[model samples]
Target chain A: MMTRTFLVALIGLSMGSFGWADNPNKPDDNTTPPSAETSVSPLPTITGGLVFNSTFTPGTQSYSPVVNPIVLVPLGNRFLFESEYNVNSDLTRDHGAWNPRQLNREIEYMQLDYMVNPHLTIVVGRVFTPFGIYIERYHPEWIRDLQVAPIIFGISHQQSMGAELRGAVHLNSKVDLTYTGFYAFNSTINYFTGDRGLGGRTSLFFPEKGVEAGFSYNRRLGDNRFNLYAFDGTWNMKSIPLDLRTEVFKTGMLGNGYWVEGAYRLNKHSHNSFLRKSQVVLRGEQYFTPSAADMAMTSMSGMMMGDNFLPDQNTTRGFAGWNYWVSDAVKLSFAFGRSFALGENQNIYSLGITYRFATGGSEK
Target chain B: MKSTLAIAFLTSLLMAVPAAAGNPSKTPHSHEIDGEAAYKANCTRCHIAIHTYSARSERTMISHMRVRANLTKDEADAIFQYMAGEQKPKAAPTHTAKGAAIP
Candidate 1:
């Protein structure tokens, strides 16, 4: 079944590309004069590409493959349409619960973006929540040192139906304010309820001499509201033997919860040759959540509880991971850690490969 | 509908109240919560402060450590309050006047 669907999509893409390149002007444009076609503007074009990911879990001897192909259709100079479908194979038998094993299931993201101006724009539809770097771009081969994400940010927060406005207002060569405001409907599958949410965020950066610091915040309101506050600082020195970039962030979740992370790339630039991609990424983190007496009672009973009614439990964890990039589009990563009283000792490893192609419009 | 609207308005007001005073640059510190001692007693078993070095995003850092530490949201807030006190302001660097350097 999946194979037939893939073939159909592949044929549609081939035919669409052929039509786009052959005519340059599409047949659907009514504005084009039936008699004087020369004066008519060109019709939008559609371009497509593919992304395939295969992973091998050494411990379990399991193999999982995911393919996410994208089709981009230009609406005009100021607008474009994007559609991507992610299909994957099963890996549940080998791994425990929470395994990302959606076999041939297709999840999609479609977006309509209007360029309000050069520095600002509005996007609506199935949108990516721009909470952090990884959540925004968690495709195969894009992120290094991957473990779906930590519970604080990764599991609890995600993308959904929404609209967002974002832009960077430059003050000078070295200073700019980047801002985004968004609203989303609760995800039926991932969220606690089907309520709607709204959030706004802003950041400031100085990028001229390799020193950058920024602050960001997001407040999501729905049936259960979640809020985040963050501060980030990074420095890059290119004159050293190897290019180096180091960054640190302090973030808070909910009303009072917070955590900190720091990363340093020592050999970031020396990989001019085949071995140059072997930069070292070292990172560490500490986070804890205390258990409330009410939560203890609720857990003890194992019954349904409201969001604000659960007893809070305290937990903390620390982990380290490494990424070895074999090429610009391929990498191998591994991370291991032990949590305190939670008893969630686990190790994760992943290998990924990617390829990218461009056609009429800019890459999403 | 009226009640729902009232509840939403009240919740929005509550959420707004925290943001006004919680800006990191605007506010320097948080008061200590009672859960700090409970966190140290229970969470130190596996999670420690040095764990912050292992993550790139603050959300990832906290979420990853939260599971291991067996912490709840309120408990997590308490520990965060403790860490807020530990945060040190970056010291101004001592500088010697350089002849050719531009200010």
Candidate 2:
């Protein structure tokens, strides 16, 4: 507790030096100096809100309490403050038709960010490890999609004593480049511990009119540490009301996988009105993973070796989903997903809702 | 009569130009997304914002999705392609001199 207090104080002191909370509205201090003009303009601001998630089972019904509350504060154009609190209860059993429960309270995310600039930012304290896209954004009540995260990337929700730095730069108005780098010193909120992994990514963009494309790579260390690479592209229709996005990714074990997603606006005139952005998404994927033993050993090696981690069998998937934006900040999604395996198949049905505060930027 | 017909044909072509220009698919452009929206909708569940911003890998991300979704190679490829295409390339990072660090 004392250590946590001291750390918070230290962060506050640093913010004060930059005149964040004390004089954020002061124009001169808030704006970047001409010599350091690469920063994202408009500086930073503080915002807060609350969100909750609940689940239901076949025979039993469950409701998660209003658990999560978040606060975000910006220091100058370089530092950001983030805190998340959760105190939800789990219902274990019932007595005489009454619900008996175990309630838990914890901090999910709390950290301080020091932006060296728009191209570089560092974070310390309890933080999240950049593992995979789904794991990084798995909260059902907070996500716009209905699917769950994959098991790779360790599947943990939080990490402590973590640090990371990431940013991007514009080569010109039509093209830009971005990168991310990170390290976690300890376990997550659930107390899982293991060796830390290193990750690097580079992406390019062409925002001239309508067509766009991007590519990226990532690597890590662990029992099953691995590498990944991908290429993606999108096109917006002119004469009709349609948009298209497609992507492909390859990994040591899964070989390569791909999907195409498109959303058409029911009403295009009002900039795809929040209520009229209702659309359908269709996706498909394929991969190969070696037998369990080979996977375990390859993961243990920590060396980047291709062809060694291929799965013994092949896995395939096909899914179609529906998504609607009730409002810009509130979204609803439903998906009927199916998986095909060794002469067998499985199916899943999912429903989800999400609400995001008005903080802006590409959190990707 | 011939001159009048040519003028009418040219006007028709001009009208088509705006229609073609308005198409996001036909044109090549960059998309500036609401970072918070992208994070909350897609990235906030398994990992939080700070973790994602730290630079996780495309392989790691795709592998996780494949395993979780039990996706086929084609399906996985499509998703990967879509995501990679959406990324905007950024400038290469430059660090300060080693001596700049505090002892």
Candidate 3:
């Protein structure tokens, strides 16, 4: 607890250096040098949402509560302070007497963004790892189609601590290129451990068609040869309310997998009731577990390769679901999945509800 | 300087209480959102702000966004116009192409 307190105090001290809170309405701080571009801006706002998921498989039931919050604080014209908090809980009940409940609360990301120019923005602190489209796009429960994450999403290097340079350049009206490259140092403060690595992702986005495909690669500094790569594609049809997304990932030693998912809105601009605000989702995936020898050779390898998650065997999973919009902020989703493996096949079912809300950021 | 910092910290802490406990908005129904509001909700979360594109660029970008974000044609147009610096909604243009997705 003391450690947490100290960390909070440290954050306070850092914010004070920017003088954002002290003089929230002060004219640009020009008297002394400023860490970021100076601006007299509105109060930094808070945004995020609460998500809850429940899953049932045979005799067991699990309820997961996810509270993810994001804070956006603009320090000045050039610098912005942003932080995301993730607090999760799992309540489980089994026929057996021993049921373990787990709670994890950590800072998912906190960073300062410096807009160097139209072509680049510099970031310092912990930032989301630009591995695949999922990490940056669909990982948030509020934005995802289904309640349960893909099996392959477990090993995604979610975040890193260090500096990143990212931005986009529009070559012409028809096409634009976006890029992110970073070098992060390894550190552990509290429950969160930063992955020290060097890597970047580059993608060409078609702004007019609402489609972009890109590739990502990362190498851990600890082990030079420990590399990961991902290729992703996204398409949103302009004629119809349909979106298709696919990603292929290969982690040097953690194994490899690919998943394709699609979401379709039933009706657009129609005055119908439920059908107007409804959406259907479908997903299929294949994963190949790393060889035992490969797992043993890698640094993040775990003991017992074939125990669960099909460490050795090839596995295929398919899921289908639907989402109903109760209101703008609240929605209901139900999904069912079947895992095909060598031995006993398992079925998974999930029903989840998510609510989203935000404050401030009303400025132009 | 120290006093200013303290006040700032206290003020931020106080502001957080309401946001954490209270609802800023309900899930926004289509009618509840407008061109600017829809643009803010859809575009701001990912990038800091929308980049200014020419009318043609905006139309294409909106077409892609319409599919990706599951936006109606009107919603996409609003965003396009917003990026084109059109704050107020206007009547449909009469010269739209026969098969153009944007009205």
Candidate 4:
């Protein structure tokens, strides 16, 4: 009986929304023709992509499809709500409660953003970790240069359930500065929540020069009061279609990591040619452990967590790849990578194709 | 009878907020949202199909889409800058795909 009542309410509610939606004065001006000036879409947006990944390590093998869908909703003019879920499913048979079955499955982020000012905005709820450029900016499969996430990418504070203040300032005509300061804690036993922590990033960018550099730090609270710091930068050449990006990470007194990467477009001067979309990339990374004991602890803990961001032990990794643009929205990528660690040698082969859809912005 | 059905329909439509993709004005007419990078990140998913509109016209038409696509002041600025010249104030091409792709 209660179910029937609820259904009636739902039906009534849906009918009301459609009624308002049909009002003639409600600005359903579908008659206006498309024009040249860029328009801001007030309508909510829905976008998602898929990933197929297989990895072979010394002790195990894995296969999975990474499908994540994200949404951004605006409430009124000052308040906005956004959320993303990583519905990853493991196809491997050796699936454990957390490993092949529950590996990295959860609502990645769900937050509300308030614009305090042009240079200051506040976010509340779960947010992307800002410890380094990679986690927050390039973690998306479609945006990422390589199919495989870097070993050190998810090292600390992937998400925080609290509050944050982030914005940018223009220093001058050529230089600009941006900052992100946030405090988060895991208030629930759900997936993707982090420990009690405070973290942020501050960067200086040269808009005209196409160059930027910055620093980030995090202080994880509670029993383990460890610190994580990183410095990152990017340089886009003015004369050619070549660019370089780098990031270095430091944790506690012992943990350290760094990666330097570069990409060059086969053609940049022309827009109509498909060859112009082809690009080549190369990268090198290194992570150092203070002692052998720490390396063991990292490896064991990583496996138990099902997110083994750290290698079996302290290691150095080199990567090379190719990115071909099937179109403006779809990209085909292949990567060949190698890892040098303490126990033995490791090889990684990654391939992925990402398709992105957009209605008003980010699409051309 | 027609009026009764209209009332019932409107009420139900209001309840189905999921279908409402509220169109927002870009400038002048409607109150502006900062439009931070966070908002742009979500916009990228479906912004694959690009549409061109004059800034003046866009500002005039605050789309009453029931779908909630929020924009911050920074994000709004970024979109404005993008539409103004299809360029951004600053860029990290090496790190991000630059030139014409939405931020």
Best by TM-score: 3
Model 3: per-residue Cα lDDT at residue A208: 57
* Residues A1-364, model 2: lDDT tens digits: 3224333433443343333222345443222222211222332322222334333333444444444555455554445566666666655333325376767776656777664322334566565444333233333344423332221222223344455444334344455444333444334335333354434333454433345455544444344555556565655454544556555666554345555655454454454344345656666666556446545665443322211232234656666777665544455666766767686566745555655443333334
Off by over 4 Å in 1: A1-63, A93-101, A104-108, A137-140, A145-148, A155-157, A185-194, A233-237, A240-274, A290-325, A334-341, A353-364, B1-103
Better of 3 and 4 by lDDT: 3
Better by TM-score, candidate 3 or 1: 3
Worst 10 residues of 3 chain A by lDDT: A30-39
lDDT per residue (tens digit) for residues A186-211 in model 3 = 78776446756666676777745767
Which regions of candidate 3 deviate over 4 angstroms?
A: A1-42, A96-98, A299-313, A361-364, B1-103
Arrange candidates, best TM-score first: 3, 4, 1, 2
Number of clashes found in candidate 1: 40
Q: lDDT score, residue A151, model 3? A: 69
- Interface RMSD for model 4 amounts to 15.1
- Docking band of candidate 4: incorrect
* iRMSD, model 2, in Å: 23.5
lDDT of 1: 0.37
**True-structure RMSD for candidate 1:** 19.1
Interface RMSD to the true structure, each candidate: 21.9, 23.5, 18.4, 15.1
What would the per-residue lDDT of candidate 1 be over residues A4-71, giving only the tens digit for each residue? 33334334433433222212264431111232212222233322223333333333434455555554
Query: Against the unseen true structure, what C-alpha lDDT does each candidate score?
Result: 0.37, 0.41, 0.59, 0.55
| Model 4, span A1-364: residue lDDT tens | 3223434554444344343232336453211222343234344655556667665554555677787777656665445677877877665544332353655577878888764433444578887767877775667777777777766774742777776656554444345556666656656566645667665777777655667788887765634555678998877665676767888888743377888988777765555455566778899998776456544444344322224355545789999988877665677887888889876677877677776644344323
